[model samples]
Target chain A: MDLVNVISYSLFAIGSFFLVVAAIGIVRLPDFYTRMHAAGKSDTLGQSLILLGLIIHEGASFISIKIFFIILFIFIANPTATHAVAKAAFLSELAPWKKDGGKER
Target chain B: MFLQVALVIVFSSIIALYRAISGPTIYDRVLAVNVIGTKTVLVLVLVEFIYERPEFLDIALVYAIINFIGTIAFLKYIEKGGLT
Candidate 1:
């Protein structure tokens, strides 16, 4: 494969790895607060990296242009959504998961 | 390559679905939906490339917008028990 192809594919692989890892975290993590870490940063980074790879592959096309905007919007929008969800959960007085035998905190 | 990634993501989304269904609280379900939304956007983009159809990009962008707005609105309603 060409050098550009190699780089893009490697990026794609790494990005997908992170994406799957984060999903597993969402499934396996013990708490909503803990799952936020998995859902927020890692997911955004993985999606961005994959889109970045696509940009490298497309190279100055309209597709790349649209992808760039999508990445920008996602970076801006996801954190806002995550924060809103967390805040709403907190405000509702949802109990945080306990470590010392799942008893009331 | 796009197909493989798409399949993996679809699988990941399915795993996330387990949490959505059995989650101890609404926040977990909302979080799961958010995760699934991200997956949906990426899959749309990948499908565009895989099928050589450019129009899917616009759909992907629109989906992203709607997902963000929907999540925010849902949180607001949940937090205050009203849209106000």
Candidate 2:
């Protein structure tokens, strides 16, 4: 109805779109490495956007501060966790998927 | 409005759940679980707004921390083939 509500709703829609993209990516990507790219980047962005919308809706308040902390945690931890998983998989000798269907390198 | 958004997120989590359940490798399942965890956080926030209960954000914050820790622990186990 008002400007704030409009902005919050639009942001919520955009965040949801990114979240769905990440989910589809995890399901459709050909390999673990590619899936990590999808999950790590899109999920972080989606969650941050949604949190931002909630913060805007709430305005200045303790809850907004808490939401901000959650955003910070997600920004820091999501990629770190993704990297850890990828590193473990690499260490375990998992091969990346090739476009030409070549043998594991 | 927020309810619709929450429903969309729930649907996405179900899709991620499929990957978690049927992934070809353990890493894929780990990644899907991570995605699902993040989505759950967003869903929690949405539910908080829908119910006018700001306190649930505390639970969402805690869940985010736990999700990150769990992912790292899973990776460590995979790398060492055990959790020692």
Candidate 3:
């Protein structure tokens, strides 16, 4: 009914949709890296939007400031975490998805 | 409206948790857990409103940091053959 409600609802819906997309990407993607691509990038954005909505709903307060801190932490950590996982996978010599005859254990 | 959005986020969290529980590989499970953590952050903020508590945001902030550290540690453990 109010502006805050409208904005928060929209943000939540969008965030939820993005999260669903990430889930689908995980289920459908053929390899670890591709799955990470979906989960890491889209989910991060989804979280940002959802947090923004919550911050709005909360209005100006100490909590809003803490939410900002959460946002900042996510901005720094999500991508770095994704990178770390990818690097570990590569270093572990896990064979990527193969096309034809080259596939091996 | 806020309630609806929270509902959607909760739905997604359940879906993500399912994936994590059934994931075939450790990485997939980790990915699912990370997604769940992101959702949890949002949920925590929402709960602050429902409970009329400002301090919960501090909990959310701490969880975010912990989740990040946990992810990094898991990755390192996977790479190094053991957690150090």
DockQ of each: 0.75, 0.76, 0.59
Question: Tens-digit lDDT track for model 2 on A1-105?
Answer: 899999988998899899899888888887888888788899889878988998898999998999999999999999998898888889888988889996422
Best-to-worst order by lDDT is 1, 2, 3
Error of 2 at A93 (Å): 1.0
Instruction: Write model 2 residue lDDT over B1-84, tens digit each, in one string.
Output: 889988999999999999999888888888888888988888898889899987789999999999999998888877777888
True contacts kept of each: 0.85, 0.97, 0.65
Interface quality of candidate 1 as DockQ? 0.75
Q: Which stretches of model 1 miss by more than 4 angstroms? A: A103-105
State candidate 1's TM-score.
Answer: 0.95
Clashing pairs in 2: none
For model 2, the stretches where C-alpha displacement exceeds 4 angstroms are A102-105
Model 2 docking tier (incorrect/acceptable/medium/high): medium
* Residue A9 displacement in candidate 3 (angstroms): 2.5
RMSD of 2: 1.9
Q: What is the DockQ of the complex in model 2?
A: 0.76
Pairs clashing within candidate 3:
none
Positional deviation of residue A43's Cα in model 1 after best superposition, in angstroms: 0.8
**Residue by residue across B1-84, what tens digits does model 1's lDDT show?**
888978988988898888889888898999999989988999999999999999999999999999999998888888778997
The local distance difference test score of each candidate is 0.90, 0.87, 0.79
